[model samples]
Target chain A: MRIFETPLYPYERSPDQDAAAPARHPVVVVGAGPAGLAAAVDLARRDIPVVLLDENDRVSYGSRAICFAKRALEILDRLGCGDEITGDGVTWSRGRVFFRDRRIYEFDLLAEEGHRRPAFINLQQYRLEELLVRRLRDLQSEGRPVELRGGSRVTKVEPAADSVLLTVETPEGPYRLEAEWVVACDGAGSTVRRELGLEFVGQVFEDNFLIADVTMKADFPTERWFWFDPPFNRGQSALLHKQPEGLWRIDLQLGPDVDREEEQRPENVVPRLRQMLGDDVEFELEWISVYTFQCARIDRFRHGRVLFAGDAAHQVSPFGARGANSGIQDVDNLVWKLERVLRGRSPDSLLDSYDAERVPAADENILNSTRSTDFISPKSETSRLFRDAVLNLAETQPMARPLVNSGRLSLPHVVLDSPLQSPDADGLPGRTRPGSPAVDAPVDDGWLLARLGDRFQLLAVGIDVPDDEPGLEVVGLPARRHPLLDERYLGGAPGALYLLRPDQHVAARFTDYDPERIAAALRRASAQETDDS
Target chain B: MTRLRTEPNIPDGDGFYEELLELHQGRSKEESDSINARLILLLANHIGDREVLREAMKAAADTGL
Candidate 1:
């Protein structure tokens, strides 16, 4: 009995087709996945009018992208969907890695940190998209300048000098749409990317993996459990994760030369599941699919008026849960820049920093995912030998435990040497450096992240920022020395001031408050837009 | 420990070789060499043992020559 439910929304052809003149929106978002929905919601919140188009009428059917990292949840929080998501999603921050039958180590991602959100949550992608859809509808009901049109497949894209022209095919007929900027979030085989003739380049593993979501009544704890070579699943790697609603995602490694069609059959899959969980453990399959991991990304995320995001811009192996989490981060990075550019607060070239910043983020994800794939499915005999040696030594040696690579789990990547950041002076804490996402800590009655509230602010940790700056929002956190805060934010010092971007990433930090550097960084972050409004 | 126990490590050597070939699919020799150089350093750092690394070097050198 498959338990996952997918309901389709009604899709009607846009009335704009027969209008007297084509309606021009400030932003047009293609695809309604997490990335596109996130982009739409973020833009709408910024008072930008947007039209969201998707070919399909429903959320994702399967329990795809189950592990949502905290950073993504924060981004979703900003878009008004985080509380509902984290409320229902199973939260976990610890995992165990096993080599063969023996458990080598148990790792805790955040050992001791008091924050509003947990380190991670396990909810199906459909559940996530459903929540986002509800949020979009709420915004729509409130008359917030967001239009979501389903079953509108973009058939053709023409990139002009000023704007991009689109031809979308709806059930009624084909219609022309134009926008000042097009956000191509139409996923991996994106029609918009194809129309532009852009290439996605990188590594594709030859081996196939079988991912199955099953519903069962078992007492499996909600921790990511991985095995390199397990007794039950003979010689190949296996991963087990518990999603909400008693659903579990199982990934079993299928080596090269597998008959993928035969492997995916329920008869074949059920037996493998029985072997992995014992024969007596009853379960019914909800969804099953076969996939090959590829670590590929485009050279740039921005192209003229058409910007690529999510799977359209980059893709990685599902090893580290980087796929959707990084995609959400991509949306987070792009939306602010897009909003600034749309508001005329920043020049159009400010959009280029999105590419500069997120390309490196995508590359980091690709590189890590590629390494995890190589380790899990070792590419050579020598590499496998080395992997085995490390796994073997990991049992007795603590140093070898760190060397073991069982999907180095997703962490929010800090932008290294971003041109938008003000350069760091000597002796500042590394946790919240320029271009790094501000690490959260406990403030007076709530979490520090809840206090940040998604705005460009001058943050004064453990002290008060001098008043008198008109445009800057100065936040003062009292000097109460918790160990975690001291180590991460203060670095055993009393106070430090930080200039933060709207995304809560540190733009600059200093021991002494300097208004000139802060002003300079604000200008650089705005891509040299010097006019003080 | 057994000195240089050379057995099949990856389940399918040919498949893994295919992946390696695909990694360098579109790269020139120079770019591929540079990639290999970077990979060598990275893997060497991971291994971090003088004797085993020496054995690996000799085995790899002995293969092509």
Candidate 2:
């Protein structure tokens, strides 16, 4: 059953209809959703040259950001639209946790078996912006240098002192642009962060989520259930999930002075979807919103030459779906350092290490979305008597179920002290140390993140690498005895030597085989000689 | 029971007591006693001021036992 009542994609106003000779772009990209079409399909697979603006040309009607994790589907399978969005998403790994309605435990974000990807996938933010606009129209019909437009609108942003000037405003008229970098995957009220006013600090959770998205057909169980206070809707918190074709995406929790247009009527969402999907099943509603829970960000997602990715550089509290999966992992860490500082191969203070590694990954996604919105809206009464004595000792204690935070879900953001990582050299195992991430297993039958694509390699599991340099790519694993690759790349060692990054992360890992510590961790992961190894 | 200035209002108090000892670092002592009973019920629900939370739980049980 197809339902995507959100369509609008038509452009060609000859580069801002010949914006009276403003031209000076190397990348402009502002809000084309899903972190500006996954940073214009990872900078047109590095043939760089983007423009991508968007004020409205549809593609975001509802079912907004439906859990995409798995490192944002391996940065959308390295921006080539991961197998057409894992064949239009729906994968799952359980997730139940209820309290006011029993069933207290069931998780399996739990994955194993030589990974390839599948820790999440619910698909729909208008099908992840129509599969990143069909991979930016297949990199604009292979003539690369993306250009996407769509009713373009930006009404100002100047940030100069080197370059960044824009004015746009189209549907036929007004224009003037320039860039040498200016990305703000505009969302979360970011008209280029309000045309460069900036200062977006944090916290706002006062509670008030509605979020509907129905279509129903019962026989549930696609997982992720979460309840808290639910006797078929009473004292707050609900959330359910399924999305993909015959949809389902609940979300209740309407407190803190509601009446915002009578709980977004459909007669207040059909008696709370007939007291939580039951009462002779059969549903309808397809999109709704009430929202209210901000966890702000942007103290710095790089300024000068402007750069900020996804929900305009940080915003959370969509419990663990970490708002567009941390804005598509902030366009996979600012499109490989804005393609090595736009091909000058690094320098431009390597964009201050993408605001020194994404302001501690946006303060760890605004402190896990403000501790899952204070453990699902427990603003007082001693945080709901310690979140109901830790969900009544998590129903029967499995050691209080990882302190039950229904949304401590999204992971992957471990730049363990990153200045582009290079320390770890001792006997391995802090689970792929050196600003972590880059673990997926199974090799020689494919998968170790499909040969760590998106380049910048040096891998080596049972060890023996360091040979393909000239833009280094080397991989050599042989000595395999998989078990999640000797526990995520040899910890009880037989050999190891990672180095990675081109957005796979882990820029350092050695147990032996030190070609000068993998050339000083590939020159401290491409910012070049930072005095360390 | 309202004498609660909550001694040392955080702010780098030795890096917030080394991230509150890295939040019971790597838990497990019954998950660090259910993470100190869910971090003293999330700091008694952020000190929702019940007589300043029974005077900071009787000065944290009479100054650390």
Candidate 3:
């Protein structure tokens, strides 16, 4: 019989006029990890409605990442959570490396000056998550609530010409969510990235390492310690970091042939740690797991309406503490742009810059972390020999110190090719240009791109505003405070001005800060309106 | 106790000496002296407070190296 199947339900129109309107949220964030949470908080603070969904019921347990760089702390400060985090976290001003019982090398993170904060701080991942969750909840209490749905697993994401449709399942039932933008922060095994059919290309290390969290009563120094060839295991190495609550994190290299199940047992780890500690101290086992390093990044971070951040976009080895810090920066880069787009102040192409600026940063960080990994834990015989030779030279030669210090590592600052930055005119060295250091400049409190302002701003430094510069606000700096100026220019005063973006990245710098040039540059940077004229 | 002279070329302070220890078990006289000099400077930088910086510099300068 040719019977037409009954439609699921007759479409009923609501009496309300808005019922017929298409569903369009300002922003939709997939995954509730640090990256997604940070994005949601920033957007919500800007009075933008955000739908943040995660598959897990609560923050994931186990110490995923513990170290945060100085820049990351600056970001947290802007988000209004830095004080709490810094107060709770341990600041390691120094670290030491050992070869068996003898001390080999040491690093001082507090080498540079004018750092608004310390170089690095160590805090457990769970504590960070707790702080973020509390802050998000507090924001919700203030009326500008971020819509966070836990256990609402997203199964399918289809990007439309103007928006994105996400099919999510929850305990109540299945529902469809439509968003003007979608951010996928679901982590390394990201379903959103896979469904989008993006390629995550890079290298995966062959060697596996065991990470053990232990409760210890030992009297070891509070500093982070690395042992190259400690007693018991030659060639193989170990990393010991002190965590809060009298806990310690130990990373030990496991041979390829070692049995994962056997080595993971508490019995195996306890003895190994004891061997390293000698007969002087006592400790108890807490948690043990094996992790393999991978240096991979998505070729394209954003595809149409779907955007990726954190481990979903890129991942690096944990050598230089770049993995989590970079992910947080990704959120910092995107949140402001997403806010502008949602507010209809800018076009979607604004999202493209996120990819342009961050992808290169990710690649550079990966390369750096890989270099550190290879040097500390050489994979090949040739690399091992080379490292040994370099160390030997550094021992005898006074000039070889910076090379070794550089090898240890530092996080990189972002430099962009936007229109806001002034072009390099005179061949001056080590000067603060667009995307360069703001070390010597006099930073103001509400001066947009001033010192420790964690948001992007347009700095019209050292410029006299002509009558025509109305929409743009300009701040003038004298030559004495602004060291980047050429001595010959502006009668010895630094005539150059810089336009800093919200993320502290310089979009453009100008030698003159001419009203017409500065306004045009700001327009180009905000991507607000194309400069056809 | 033997003293080492500060050299102009080296950048980091005694931290380099500590790092050198990681690479080589020990070094020659020249290496030890230079590393000590670098360490003193690095520590001076770390004590960024002007008073602290000066104190560290004075201590290093006065030490028999």
All candidates' lDDT scores? 0.82, 0.79, 0.68
Q: Give a tens-digit lDDT track for model 1, residues A141-246.
A: 8889998998899999998778888988988888888899999999888899989999989887788899999988677666888889887666689998998888
Candidate 2 lDDT over A124-173, as tens digits, reads 87887887888788788989988878777889888777678898888777
Error of 3 at A48 (Å): 1.2
Preferred candidate (lDDT higher): 1 or 3? 1
The residue pairs in collision within model 1 are: none
Worst 10 residues of 1 chain A by lDDT: A1-10
Q: What is the CA-based DockQ of model 2? A: 0.11
Candidate 3 residue spans exceeding 4 A from truth: A1-23, A391-410, A416-431, A436-496, A511-513, A529-533, B1-65
Instruction: Give the poorly placed runs of model 1, Cα more than 4 Å off.
Output: A1-8, A100-110, A466-470, A481-486, A529-533, B1-65
Question: Measured by TM-score, how close is model 2 to the native structure?
Answer: 0.33
Better of 1 and 3 by DockQ: 1
- Which ranking of candidates, highest TM-score first? 1, 3, 2
TM-score of each: 0.87, 0.33, 0.78
Q: What is every candidate's C-alpha DockQ against the true complex, given to 2 decimals?
A: 0.04, 0.11, 0.03
Top candidate, metric lDDT: 1
Clashes of 3: 26
Candidate number achieving the greatest TM-score relative to the actual structure? 1
Clashes in each model (backbone N, CA, C under 3 Å)? 0, 0, 26
How far residue A29's Cα lies from its native spot in candidate 2, in Å, is 1.1
